[model samples]
Target chain A: MTVSLDLSDVTAHYGNTKVLEDLSLHVAEGELVSLLGASGCGKTTTLRLVAGFLEPTSGRIKLGETDLTRLPAHSRDIGLVFQTYALFPHLSVRDNVAFGLKQRGEGRAARQRKADEMIERVGLAGFADRFQANLSGGQRQRVALARALVIEPRLLMFDEPLSNLDAKLRVDMRVEIRRLQQINGTTALYVTHDQEEAFSISDRVAIMNAGRIMQLDTPEVLYSRPANLFVADFVGFENVIPMRAVAEAGDAVRAEIEGGGMIDLPKQHYTVPAQEFVLASRPEGLLVDTADRTDGLPAKLGLRTYLGRAYQYQCDTTAGPVKANGPLGTPREEGEIVTLIPQPEQCCLLPREAK
Target chain B: MQRRAHPALIAFAVLTFLFLIGPLVIIVGAALSDTSYLTFPPQGLTLHWFQNVFEISAFKRTMITSFQLAVGGTALSMAIGIPAAYAMARYRIELPRFLGNVFVLPILVPEIVLGFSLMKSVAVGSGVPIMGALLLGHALLVLPYCVRVVGASLNSFDFSIEEAAVSLGCPRWKAFFTVVLPNVKPGIIAGFILAFITSLNDVSISIFLTGPGVSTLPIQLLAHMEQFFDPTIASVSVLLMFVTVAVMAIVERTLGLTFLTK
Candidate 1:
């Protein structure tokens, strides 16, 4: 059965200091969600609260119709895999897998059968008898996974499970973990700091900052239509220009270019913010010119970097020195006058107050 | 033109070794003295003291008492220590720094002082018997070691395994037993054994708490030495040395002595 987790206004604290503040989330059944953030954003804290390791200071954690907030970790039927892959060093892979079953009073034969199946499922078919201490980092992680899945938990939480592996191994393990979750149809809440990992595997990525979720959306929406300036900036919106309304219509605005040029703003636009706004455009959306043209703004080219598949150029613009990418073999020279044009469809405007 | 080892470092090492083992070496040499005296560099070689030590009924009885105390103390300390260590390591308990200080204070205080205080508090006021008193004292003394060793192991241990167990449908206690406890076993065993040894060789506390009939081996040895300068004492010391060597071997095999040294 696919389990769904509902966290409503979950508040957690360490004595007087609050770690999580009025956190609310709804993870649909069979959905793979990631809590993405830097350190101290309460990402790990959220996972711990759901796993019953830390009781919420206030709020309800429910799995389907079952209230799990009051229950201890063991009674919650939630599985957790930590980043360090805390395998019992003394136990063999098979025994490690069998541990939970034995504790629940499953028969010896039944436990062994279940453990063997889990071991095979995690690709440790031949390493059943080997102690965890002797296994490689990837092998130990798989053993930990087998041990967790053996109990058939209703909900699974991964505490940055792939963060311990090397870069190449992390990518490989992320695929394996996602594949396993998909095959099992498990409800998963994965916490991680790597934005790319969150974008790759999560059905919904919750971007957290300062104990609150800044934005929660699918990878596409988070990248394309961020809720605020922070989310836009964090998602790599490169050039943010200040735009003042040229007319009293409010929507009709003009961005004064650094050199000598002005870009017109369309009034009564549905997407543009009405308040005093700053315009943001991604580097891929901005076009650079090498020679001076009548319609293009003048740019003092500083450096041009050949990036194999594309050209990365740094130019002095009205918004200060800005960086932008062009085609692979663009004939752009250093110390050349250039004009920059922004694709209106790709530009995002944020409230002027957004820092 | 050749570089020399640091004379001060070498001299300090030699002095430390001698300070620690000088008495044991003396007792070993005295065991072989043909003349009935606790003197090193014996005039003649003999095993008469070994024969005498074996024949002493008090020695046999006291050895049993000390053995029981050490074993019982280790069990009691481990029961409370392992979980306490885990709690300290895994959770952010209120005033953890204060609790940590309290746990280690027992080790810092003089053994004689702790022994007497415990006897007054638990034995005299609480009406605990001599055996109970000895067991209580020894357990308290060893509690700090158990916490330090087991707690240190848990601090360095990867907690992901416990999380894995929890995620697998195992309850918190079961997960701890299956995942956390098993991983910290080596540290627990090392701590337990060290606590046992400490209780075994304890003389300062045992001296004050020992009743008329119940006495630990170390107290018995001290009593025996006061009355006689016999070879039997030397033989008993040799046996004690052997036990210490065995303990060192076990510590080396289980949790490396390097950590203990630190």
Candidate 2:
């Protein structure tokens, strides 16, 4: 049976440099949670901490009510798949899959039987006796997945598991890993720098920056409604319009852009602070309006490029440069005076962060 | 496109190989000679010297002593060197450069000079027995190669495998045996064979260390040569070469000797 994992206020360091600062996360039973971030953002470090390679300086880590912070890696009973597919080079595929069983003092016949079953499940029926050296990269990935799953570990972890494969094989292996993890119903934590890889396979994705989770949500919510400026920018929000709330009108609030223009937004659509805030929008959310429009944020079109289904424009505004998309039928020319409007469905309002 | 070997390069390689093996060929030829003295071209073919090599009481006695020294020295060096090499390569020890340089210091000193120093310190000054002295000296002599070869392998080893083992329910200590040791098997075999051969063929160190009624085979053979310069010495040399070649062949067949170059 699988179990949930919880880390309460975990803080970790590499010597004097603090990599994680009182961070916490939880993965529910049989659920997949991905730690998605750039390098050095502590995603891999978080996985290592859960795997018992690094003990938190001050925190309580629990796996299904069993405290794991003080336990050694071997006693933690977690399965980890490395980026390099760290299979034992000297052992056969079946033997490598059975290594955990062997270490747990299982008889040879029992280990061999279970290992062979796992090998066949990963679609490596004929490769039971073959060593990792002879296997292809994709085949080796399957072997790694089988080995980690064979022990029925409480939690399974993957550190950039598909980074070594080619583009095609990476997608295939990603599906295989997700399917295998689901079929076994094991709680798992995945760490990856690839956003698409994370979003496609994870039940929830935690976007990380500077060792902290900026936002934790499902792919749909994260794609449409980013919680803050950092996550909005990460999820492809190109323009951040700084604004100040001026007044409230019935069920809507009136806010003025920092440089010019004012607009009313439904109060239910945004939660802005009392003073300053940000209007974060994807390129498609901010539309290039007709020249001479009255209720549009002021801008001067600098360049225009065709984007297959739409035309993207570079607009110079009073606050900063902005990239926005306009309809393909009406392409704006360079140096044309234009106005930009925000579409509420593709845009979000976030509170200005305290530095 | 097909590639062709340059004529001059081919000739150079042939000349270099012949230069290396010419002396060995002559020695083997002389080993089967029917002669009173060591000679390259034999007057006739005979196996008398091979039979004579078995009859010498000193040869039999010294052979056993030499065998003991080789096996004991190799075992002692490997037992110490494997862990020492692993620690140096894997750990963030203080002054890593200094520790590496210190382990390799014995090899830098001339063999005869080191042997003389050890003889004075371990044999005469300390009153240790001659066999004990020889065993200790031989172990010291081969320790450097064992550390060096195994250390090279450990340096390039993907230590993530060891971590994987630990994460897979194997204890840290057992991870070394089940994962690290098996992965670095080539280096261990290379180190062991190098130590064994060096200890067996060593003469300079044995000269200063051997005492009354206790001498290594090479030292004993040298004393025999002074009295009778014969084909029997050539036969003994051939036998030593055979053993070395056989050991190397087994290594080549098993894990391959490519790691030797590495």
Candidate 3:
């Protein structure tokens, strides 16, 4: 049940304008990889390329030993769950699930057995005779997933699978999809713009921008150690401070921060460059007005509001307005001078790339 | 709500309806006339002209020819138009914008011009006979309307459904037949009926391409009207009206007229 996909230097274009460019990533056996990006970032195009719906402008797509670049979509043996959950409006739930099996020329009983098995797997056993128009949105999505996965394809792809659902249903369905993928041990690729959805379900998440993969890593690493500014910004790093590299006498390099503030770069923690770089920090990594915290930088708090178990403060710092989330009971007022300290280990240094 | 009618508006509406229905009512009335001449008011009400129309072999032959041509023309148009519409809908092929214009340009050309063009192209260049020439002409004339209707339908269709099917291991052709074609059937059906009726009632192109012993019903009716001023042609006209109305009613029943307007 192991499946590995290799997309090497893939580029896709719509006429003269390129949609995906030199995109490359790999999903190990039975791993769920998510391509997370904003709209028009070529995430769907990459999924389509892997599914063989679109021919790459120039590249190779290898699934284990088979090169699927030239293969048609059906021959690629990849399952795709569409964003709209495109179930056949005319077919019964059972017939929709049986479509692929019948296409393979399976006998009547065999097809019905497989369809019934898949229907139960998706928790729609009793609704097999129901038409798609009679089902709810969640049930329709589950049926679409069953139709895609019933064939046991080499690769499974979901195109914004949970985007159409409400917030609560999205959370529940994403967990269910992840559980099903893991239980079946299927190699899956999930495309979505929701950062929380990508982080929650993916073993590895690839952040894309302008037809290129900016970074690919586990969710924890992507959040704490994004490779560039795009991935940092996309992964919810609210503050990206501008820094110029300076010489360190011994253990640390002195980096000149923007707005006349300076911070010593711990050589072990950061990737120091020769000239200039940017330091990225997530909102949760910044600590404000704590007695035991070291490296406290002076900042003016603008607004303070309680967010569940945390206090969200908008502070005007050397790096513009920084949004920092602190512990719920922390005392802070608007227009009050406070010292905000960022965790040294959690701060990510990225080489500057043009917007 | 009170149902009060404005006298002027009511009069205008009645006049418009009469203006539209006057010719058909007069023709139907003449079809039942006992007189040999076609007159607005019948001297005697009878079914004699209908019997005359039925007894004539020319009328029967022409009706059969028209039915065959219309059916063949519709099938041929569907064979070419459906796939062309699908391709235009899915793929960003080269010159599709231009191809669309080329497909619809035939409709803009007058039927007389199309008739002459078909005659010079097929009748002279390839040396096809009268049947071949008539079919070729009708297919060409009706193809653009089919493409326009079917293409409009395909435009509104969801492309993702076909992709979903293909990814489920159904081949592209199977996916098209199962997912795409079934969804677009309403439009295809409307286009089929429209093309059929257009071919059936066509006189300009049919008259030019059809040789001796191969006249269509409209051409036969025109020939009868010119040679003899009789109510028999009016009876034939009423029969043709029935055929057109029946075909239109079937189309409206099957696909709904809303498909046409959309």
Best by lDDT: 2
lDDT for residue B116 in candidate 3, whole number 0-100: 87
Q: Residue A279's C-alpha lDDT in candidate 2?
A: 85
Higher-scoring candidate on DockQ, 2 or 3: 2
| TM-score, model 3 to reference | 0.92
Say which candidate scores most in TM-score: 3
Higher-DockQ candidate of 1 and 3: 3
Considering the two chains of model 1, state its CAPRI-style docking category. medium
User: Can you list the residue pairs that collide in candidate 2?
Assistant: none
Q: Runs in model 1 with CA error above 4 Å?
A: A103-105, A248-261, A265-270, A290-299, A327-330, A333-337, A344-346, B1-23, B92-94, B116-127, B253-256
lDDT of 2 by residue, A1-355 (tens): 8899998899999878899978888899999999999999999999999888887888889999899999999999898999999999999999999999998899999999999999999999999999998999999989988889998899999999999999999998899999999997999999999999999999999999888898999988999999888888989998988888888878878888887777677777667765788888998988998767644578899888888989999998876889989998887789988888878889988888876
Structure candidate 3, residue pairs in collision: none
Give per-residue CA lDDT, model 3, range B1-262, as digits (tens): 9989999999999999999999999999988888889987887899988888889999999999999999998898889988888788776466457878888877899889988888888887788999989988888889987988999988888788888788778888888888999888888888998899999999999888888678899999998889999999999999989988998889788777777777
Candidate 1 lDDT by residue in tens digits, A142-225: 988887788887887888888878999889888988988888889999999999999999999999998899999999889877
